[model samples]
Target: MLRRLALTAVVSLATLSAVTPAATAATGPVPLPLPLPVLQDDARARLTITVSGSEDSAAEGTFELRCAPAGGSHPVAERACDRLDELAGEDEDPFAPVPEDALCTLQFGGPATARITGTWEGRHIDTVFSRTNGCEISRWNNLIPVLPNVR
Candidate 1:
C-alpha cells in the first residue's frame, strides 16, 4: 500500500509540474515585439500599466499606436488615414517617418506604468493604456507627422 501511494504521489508531481508551466507561459513575460508608437494628442491621455513578478524585457522595434477620441473609444491600427484623419481633424500620412527601430522597456516589478503625452495612431490605435514603460517624449508625445509614403 505504501509503495502504491508513493507511486501515485510521484505521478501526481510529474503531472502537476508539466501542467504548471503551461499555465505560467500563458501569462509569462512577453517580450517586446517592437517599439509601439502610441499617439498622444491630449493632455489628460497618459496612462499606467502594472506587471507582477520578476521578468526581463527589451525593446523590439518602432511601433506606432493611436488613441481614440475624447471618450476613450479606442482606435484600430493600420486601418488607414482616410478614416483617422476625419477624427484627428486631418489625416495622417501613412508614409511618415517613424523610428524604424524603437524598443519598448519594462517599467517595474509587480506593476509597470507607461505614460505618454501624444496621440498614437497607426492602422488601429491601442486604447488599452498598457504599462509599456518607455516614453521618449517629454511634455508632449514625440510627433512624427504622418507622411504619405510609409503606408
Candidate 2:
C-alpha cells in the first residue's frame, strides 16, 4: 500500500511538471508590432509659441504645446489642442495668411505680435500673428487661447 501511494505521488508530480512548462509558455510575453512612422506623426502634435509687444506682461513669453496627448507649458494646452482639432475637422488652415486682395479695416488692435512654429497633423507649420489690422486681428482672435488673449 505504501509503495502504491508513493508511485501515485510520483505520477502526479511528473504530470504537474510537464503541464507547468506548457502553461508558462502559453502565458509568455507577446511580441508587439513596430509602430508606423506616419501613424506616430498623426498621433502627436507639438508647437512652440512666442509672444511679444503685448500690453499684458504675463502674455509675453515663449510657451511649449503638445497635442493628441495634450500637455505643455502653454496655459490652456487642452483647450488650444481641442480648438486646433476642431479647425482641422472643418478643413480650415489655422496658419493661412490673409489674402492680398482682401479688404481689411484699418483698425489697429495693438502692437502685439506672436510667432508659432511646430508640427500639426503631420505637416510643418511656421506662422506669424499680429494685431495690426482688422483681418489680422480677426485671425489672431480666432486662434484664441493658442495665441494668448492680447486684450
Candidate 3:
C-alpha cells in the first residue's frame, strides 16, 4: 500500500511538471505593449526628450521615466507601461535588473517611438540615459543644467 501511494505521488509530481510548460505555452507570452513618453513641441512647451529601443533586441516590460530638475532641488516625473485592460500578470518587467530610482530612469519605454517629455524643475539632473537592448535597459549619463534660454 505504501509503495502504491509513493508511486502515485511521483506520478502526480511528474504530471505537474510536464503540464506546467504546456499550460504556459498554450497561452504563450502575452504581447507586451509600450507606453511612450509625452512630448509637446511649442514655444510654451518648455521641454522635450526622446528615447528608443524598438530595434528588435527589446524584452517585454514597463518603462518609467523621470524628469527631475537638472540641478538645485526639484521633484521627479514617473511613467509606467501596461494599462488596466492590458497584460499585467503576464509581464516580465524588462526593467527588472535596474534600480527604479537610478538617475538613468529618465529614459525608458519601447524600442521604437518611445518618446518622453516633462518640464524641468531647477537645474542639474545627475544623469541622462539612452535605451538599449530593452526598454528598461539604459546607459551613460547626460547631466543637464539650466541656463538662460538654454534650449
TM-score of 1: 0.18
- Our tally of clashes for model 2 stands at 0
Tens digits of per-residue lDDT, candidate 2, 30-143, equal 444344223134345699999999999999999999998898899999999998888788777878999999999999999999999999888889999999999999999999
Q: Distance (Å) between predicted and true CA of 6, model 3? A: 87
Give the alpha carbon lDDT tens digit for every residue of 46-109 in model 3.
Answer: 2333433434433212333333212212112211211211212444422134465555434444
On lDDT, the leading prediction is: 2
lDDT ranking, best first: 2, 1, 3
Displacement of the residue 84 alpha carbon in candidate 1, Å? 91
Error of 1 at 99 (Å): 87
CA lDDT scores, all candidates in order: 0.34, 0.85, 0.33
Model 3 Cα shift for residue 24 (angstroms): 89
What overall lDDT, based on C-alpha atoms, would model 1 receive against the true structure?
Answer: 0.34
| 1-151 per-residue lDDT for model 1 (tens digits) | 6566667766776776677767668987544334323433442222212212213242212233333333321232333233344435645532233343866454422222232223333232222222234432210122222211111
